[model samples]
Target: MRYTITGGAGFIGSHLAKALVSKGHSVDVIDNLSTGSMSNLDDIKNKISFHKTDILDADSLEGIIQNTDGIFHHAALTSVPESFTRQQEYENVNVNGTENIFKIAKKLHVKVVFASSSSVYGDTKTIPTKESHKLDPINPYGITKLNAEQLATKYLQFFDVVGLRYYNVYGDTMPGAGVISKFYYCIQNNMPLEIDGDGKQLRDFVYIDDVVNATISSMEKNTGSCFINVGSGVATSILELANLFLKYSGSASKIIFKQQDKGNVMTSQADILFAKQLLGWKPQTTLEDWIKNLYKS
Candidate 1:
């Protein structure tokens, strides 16, 4: 099978690309290298066709994405704090770029498994939010992701689309280097680990391997058109995560508290029964296990 992955040079996309290549599938990577690094694809560079093009370029995207079995759409501006100042840019890249992919996929009659975010739930009243939870994003980035999901719903009549509402997806090479990576960086550099707000906020940090597996399953399995939450379904507090990092790394680095960014949610936990029911996928990595292993060396 042949596949196309937008933003394939980034963290999650790069991992997916490598996985596909390992399975002896032909892969094509499309990335502008704006936030993604070429080094991420260095090992598999020659194995796949790499296109240095943005998703907004329909002509280029359509040309490369044609004849593909499926598309894993991961291209977007994904910074929450940054989205506030650059709302229009977020809308352009996340919403408009997504629509472009849907339009092209519609033309080609291909399936798209795109990245959505857990932020769409905002600070919901429900704990362990379900797919049926109300979507009321408090930030521009979440708003754009919600818009993209809506687009996916609208395009379902034409082709198959699965939008995975990813929670805090973290790994060794996560793009934008999420909280776990940031903590590791501080530990390595002997710097203080900074926590916004009271460090009591809870989050569901899903490992990249599990996320990649779930993503691939979504495309391979006939899940139809739906949005599912991809996460560990376990909620860990920020302070607990910090302590775990300190314990594993043996770092004496102090954890500092700072003001929380605007639109930051207090807690996020995924009710992933839908994912298991639809794709037969469930997260295998725990935050504690990954952190302990990372510093075990």
Candidate 2:
């Protein structure tokens, strides 16, 4: 099977592409290099077809949609504060870009699995937000993701679609791709790990490997219009996560607390019961284990 992963050179997308390739599937990537790096795909540079195109460009995207079997749509502007600063850019990339993919998928009879975010649930009133939970995104980035989910649903009336509400995905793909990686890097270098507010903010941090596995399961097994939360169903506070990283890295650098981010979500987690039932997938990494392996090499 031939698979096209938009943002394929990104942290999660790059890892997913390699996984698909390892499974004997032909993989192609479309990336704008906005935040995705060519270096992330250094090992498989010669093994796969790569297109330097943006999903926002419909004509460019349409040219490549005809040849792929399924599409993993992962391209978007993903920064929370950045989205707040540049609302229109987020609207263009997350909302309009998604529409373009769905439009081309509908036209080409292609199956699509979108990389949605847990941020769409905002600071959920529930500890572990289920797919049935209310979506009250507080930040513009989350709002755009929620809008993309809606657009996907609207398009599903005409196309086969699955959306995975990925939790805080972190792993070995890129050094600075996620907050965990960044914090670890800082700790290793004896630099202060910046903590926003009191470090009480919580998240359902999932490993990239698990996220990719669940994403593939969603693509292969899920039918009709489906949305599932892909997470560990575990919540860890920011301070606890930092401590774990420090323990793993064995760094002596002290954490520095800073002023709280105004628009940041205080807490967010995922309820993956539906995913377990439908995709038969659960997170395979624990915080302690992942952190230990993170600093091994």
Candidate 3:
């Protein structure tokens, strides 16, 4: 099947594209290059079609999705803090851009898999969050993701749609998308890993390979407007992560403490039972193992 991945040059999108291409599927990428780099796709540059386009540009996106079988909507302004300051830009790119995808997909009858966020649950006492958990977003980035997810659900009345609420995803070659990425970069550069709020804040950090596998399996089996948490169902504290990164990289660096970030959740753990049931997928890598592997040749 022919696939078009938005933000295909980005971290997760690049991994997904390579996975699909390895399986002998035709792949096309439409990335605005806002955060994505062409070097990410260098390994498979000759295998897939690349288009420099934004999701907000309906005319350009329309042409690309014309003959496409499915789309993985991954493009958006992803930073939580930046979203607070650039509310209008996030709304336009993340929300309106998603709406545009739905519009075009509706016309062409194409299936869509939306990349949503776990932040939509906001500051929760709930240990492991379900897909039906409250949709109260603490930040504008989360709000935009929730909006996009809602659009996918609405469009499901006409076409096939799947929404995956991703937790803190980390992997090799990924940029400073989250704390883990920062940890990797800092460890390599001999910089301190800064922790906010005592570093006890828990997060369900899922490996990228597992996320890509779950995404594909869910997209294939989803028959309705199905949504599920794409996470490891395991929570790790920020302090634990810092120790692990230091251990793996064999680096001796102090962890600095800072004021807690506003609009940030204290804890997040995903109830991935739905993913297991729906996609028959489970995360294979543990935090320690992934970190160890990351530093290996």
Q: What tens-digit string does per-residue lDDT give for candidate 3 at 132-166?
A: 88889999999988888877777887788888899
Question: In candidate 3, how many Å is residue 14 off?
Answer: 0.6
Q: Which candidate wins on TM-score? A: 1
RMSD (Cα, Å) of candidate 1?
1.0
Residues 1-297 of candidate 2: C-alpha lDDT, one tens digit per residue: 999999999988999998998898999899999899999898888888999999988998998778888999999888887788999999999999999999989987888999888888888777878899888999999999999999987888787899888888887765464678779778767899899899899988888889999988878884678888988899999999889888878888898999987668988888889998888788889877988887796
TM-score of each: 0.98, 0.96, 0.96
TM-score of 3: 0.96
Between candidates 1 and 2, the one scoring higher on lDDT is 1
Q: Against the correct fold, how does model 2 do in TM-score?
A: 0.96
Query: In model 1, how large is the Cα lDDT of residue 43?
Result: 90
Residue pairs in collision within model 3: none
Winning model by lDDT:
1
As for lDDT, the candidate ahead, 2 or 3, is 3
Clashes of 1: 0
lDDT by residue (tens digit), candidate 1, 112-151? 9999999999997788899999999999999999999998
